[model samples]
Target: MALQLIALSPIVLISSYLPFASPSNFSYPAIFNFGDSNSDTGGLVAGIAFPLGPPNGQTFFLKPSGRFCDGRLTIDFLMDVTGMPFLNPYLDSVGAPNFQTGCNFATGGSTILPAKANSTSPFSFGIQVAQFIQFKTRVHEILAQDKKIQQFLPFEEYFGQGLYMFDIGQNDLDLAFYSKSDDQVLALIPTILAEFEIGMKELYYQGARNFWIHNTGPLGCLPRIIATFGMDQSKLDEIGCVSSHNNAAKLFNSQLHARCVSFQGQFPGANLTYVDIFSIKSNLISNYSQLGFKQSLAACCGYSGLPLNFDNRINCGETKNLNGSFVTAEACNNTAEYVNWDGNHNTEAANLYVSSQILTGKYSESPLLGDSHLLAISEI
Candidate 1:
């Protein structure tokens, strides 16, 4: 039976989840995001003074926008569809950012677990939640001090009314896979979820009631994973992804789905929707050609120009010395043709496609609660 299923195309497996455009009036006043590079707008750059050079945001912003992608992220699309302005990073105090609608606490390279000395971002899930709490408190405090500033900060009621989006846990799995065997990493899933739950509970305690959580994507399919582990052909799946890594992601998603289901009853009046990002991304990669993508698993902005085009020593927009010669990992001529952007991130075009899938509400375990404008924007 398993062989028969594996033999079937990915399109067949995902046919049932086809999204339909529906007209609805659902809406949220604000949105709060917590995650890593996948959803980060500029949290990492604002928080730690990190620099993301050009070509990272050339596709959309025409310059680096602190996002890992060449264009907008799924969160950016979500905001646009919902009629909200781009969320201001909580740590960004410059540019007179207006957080009246929402604020993002996500940072690149963040994880659910506590950060180690060498962790990419010191802002772990716990730290992000703490920042959210601080943001909420300060917003109210400043509002109380001056009524005129109410237009710049979120209302106290928006905390409970707004959408709380989560896209973390991928980095946690990446960290686990770095040190432990597959089984050991599997064993750590519960602990990671426990920490995730703690952070959710903290937010719930702080008056957040609507949660939209995205399960981790197919980690094995990432160009970075393939380039790092694909030397062993036996380890690759039928679609050329690292089988063990994807299996781990599947297990994590299952456990996360169950947890989201439980949160509904545990937190009264809370609306929790668990999104199946794995299926969406896996299907996209599985049928990239049919979807109009030229490259499925290769990074558009990477070195080597190989099948995967990834090099650990070189990152997008950074020049590195290889064999005493400087080589810059430049963006490809057309980013829309490729799915992967910098080995780990998606291109703006791919992110838009993924967000369109999400807005369909079919991949969501429960019916999605989105604004009416989202329905219109999804068509694009």
Candidate 2:
């Protein structure tokens, strides 16, 4: 599959100027992120009981820290590429670490909309923004107490110069599909984008200038979704994915790109870059063999089953007894050769590849860190 570059919005084309100081001279002081499991560092561990034990983070962290992947997420890779330290979850044990550098407020199962009336967790996108406000206040108080560290005092210098990323909306769509038809799910895009715009505007008011927004990926092609919906041969596309879901994703991405254009007009100084992860991952799936992936549609670490190797009853690293024997979910020896890690998330290897490709500025609405900057950061 040849990599195709999505057309850039006019505002993005004009705003491609590198604003920060040369990477050799200065680095982004901090990075703040908002989203769901796609970027959650450890928020789930702090807020809920999600079993992200052994095989989950074994590929990178060596132990589970509430991440949904079998290793580092896209956010983790972005931190590495930019020379920033891994962010600590804001909801982690009170004294676990300091938040001077930055903090992550994302949680698994979070959505852009308010949780259902009966929902228990209040970690919605709006709530995450509220947490960020609280974080800013705490950082201000700490700087006030220590005069010597007051350089990081002013909000603009502290927040505006840093990177702010968002990797949400997947859960919103997921929830919608549970009780709605395909057209109904498509109808919800406007509401979802409206909620996201509100959040982005709030952040802009809070002094965020550099933004990296990731559009949702192809949710229909996920191994779990495929196994559930791709039972009919006629319903599958050439690539073996449910066409309706993927089409819905493409529709969402289109609207998101247009909204980003309007956002640039609203805040001309803000560098808001849209990342087309849909194309990046879709191409990877289509060319999995060339990309070194042996299993593109099946999970690498999931319970073995009939139609596909994914079992909802047994998550990765879990075991179940059938009849007289015990069957356990296990990780494959060659994780790097698979795109989907545990049915929904990407493997560490896939994340690494996607990060590298996006950083090259091919899939971004605007150029990301330049080669010189990347080189400088990598050396650091």
Candidate 3:
């Protein structure tokens, strides 16, 4: 279950970004984002959760919106590309007054299985989408004053064309695969996949068309996991991938690829594209030097723990005596050199590269897949 959830985080990431930028076909009227930390614009929920500290948003928003990353999540980039209002985080009371443009219902670490563990950043996709539906209802009320759908021109013709994107499904697998017994882990995949499919269908029923689906990325190479497990390089081959973790991720991605193909075949209006973000991500990490990346195996915002630092829990602000004066977070002289920001997530520069592949993939969608998937809407 955990592996399946994480595998789908790429899906959520792509969903949020598709609307964030100008789609090759045309710009979306408005982008509705639902899921977890992958697409977070707002950091934490107001009153519901406390705001995090400085390093959290050290790069972009520069003031922690409760996002797990340093700067903007996918939604901010989408706004820039599409020329739309930055979707307001659902928690902002001020924005709610007349936020007919669009909104984000994403929270950190939410998962599909309520019983799933808590390692995921915030809210589950199911919970976030519910909030999005409520927000849409409010928007409908506001749009009542105007036409059912506003028409701007050749560019804005598809504005507000119900572009709902979700980024989720990773944390679920992380908990199950890493924490549970072997048999227990295998037992959960079918049930988890079923719930995930239902979740997708529900979004379609709620008016989400032109879907952007992302498959799982490589999970075996997390800095935190390596730092924690302390696996001697001698035990493994040149690649640095843990034997079990790599095998598990391969299995998950294989199933995911087949399922997405089936999904595309069955769903007409819903056009699902399975993105192999894992290979790209793995290659980037492995070839960090070739990619002009400085730090590949360390985390910029985590804590290097006592025993289990496989994922390198090195916190951002700590000071240590390295060569002479001191050293702190695994911060590189240049963020572009580092593929990972924290142990589990990637930095802004890496996301740009990943998003480019997603936008150009064959699954590029239009307003929706009509009888004929025209370039007007079919461009990724």
Candidate 4:
């Protein structure tokens, strides 16, 4: 399959000094994001008052910035290319955030299907889409009543011009593994993708024309999964990852890719691009030493222990009493040297590398090298 690049329709800009100006020929007036922690800017923290305390954002933001990772995610890197401000969470009302460019409905621990009773996040994929609808409706409502606040809200046309991005489904697969057998989990992929299709259809009907969809990465390689399932030697793969989990992820991605291909035909006016995040991340894990990462599977911000260093009870940036001693899951001395950040997320360095690969268009089904619009974005 040819790598399908993100091709946006060119819109003439009157001013070159606009804050949302894109250096590239293509200009996405805004970006509407949806998914889990992989792309969540801050929805989880603001929505439920989740305590994502210190050391989470110490490397980049130098404070708790609502991200599960230590720094910016791959979505953040992609947003920088458009020269727009980092998207504010839809649930966040603090600081009177300006949503002129975009809003993020993603939350940490979100799933495509409605969450279970004990789930940490209540804003499931369906809820996130509902929030987006409310946001769009309110934007128009407020605009109709008053014109003074127009500067802070997205233009009516931005809905069609902006990029709608998704990076979810990892948690859905993870949740299935905890209860269902391998065969049962594989059987659930079709149902999960069906829900995803419904959400896409909703967005398409709502005037969202451009879409950038990312396939889930190798969940088997996550430090959290390996620490929990590693004792069972029979379940391990050649590279020390849980074979069953990886297989499930592959199956999910395969079905998702097919769905995206079909969506192109279903939504005639939409540009749906499916990015292969699995290959990029799997390669990084398999060749970490060659890629300048010291720890491939171990977490940088996790409980202090050899190998994986992940404790389910003691999350990253958390302190607890263990074995008559107080142990805090502090971050490692060097972050860039580790691929995994806190067992479940990737490090800032890893995210940067992944975004670079995305821009190269090599990970996509189509070529990205010679596209003038793609080459203009800063490589960093």
Q: Residue 145 of candidate 4: its Cα lDDT? A: 98
TM-score of each: 0.91, 0.86, 0.74, 0.91
Q: Is candidate 2 or candidate 3 better by TM-score?
A: 2
Model 4, residue pairs in steric clash: 2-365, 2-366, 3-365, 3-366, 4-366
**Candidate 4 overall Cα lDDT vs. reference?**
0.84
Residue range 119-165, candidate 4, lDDT tens digits: 98999999999999999999999999999998999999999998898
lDDT of each: 0.83, 0.75, 0.56, 0.84
Candidate 3 residue 116 Cα shift, in angstroms, is 5.2
* lDDT tens digits by residue: candidate 1, 1-380: 00122222323422321233222434788899999999999989988888789888997799888899988898886676566788888888889999989989999999999999999899999999999988888888888899998888888889989989999999989888889999999999999999999999999999998888999999999999998888799999999999989999999999997787677668767778788899989988998887767899999999998699999898888988899999999999988788899999998777867876776655776533323223333443
Output the better candidate (2/4) by lDDT: 4
- Residue 76 of model 3 has an lDDT of 68
lDDT of 1: 0.83
**Cα RMSD (angstroms) for every candidate in the order listed:** 6.0, 6.9, 7.9, 6.2
Ranking by lDDT: 4, 1, 2, 3
| Alpha-carbon runs more than 4 Å astray in model 1 | 1-24, 367-380
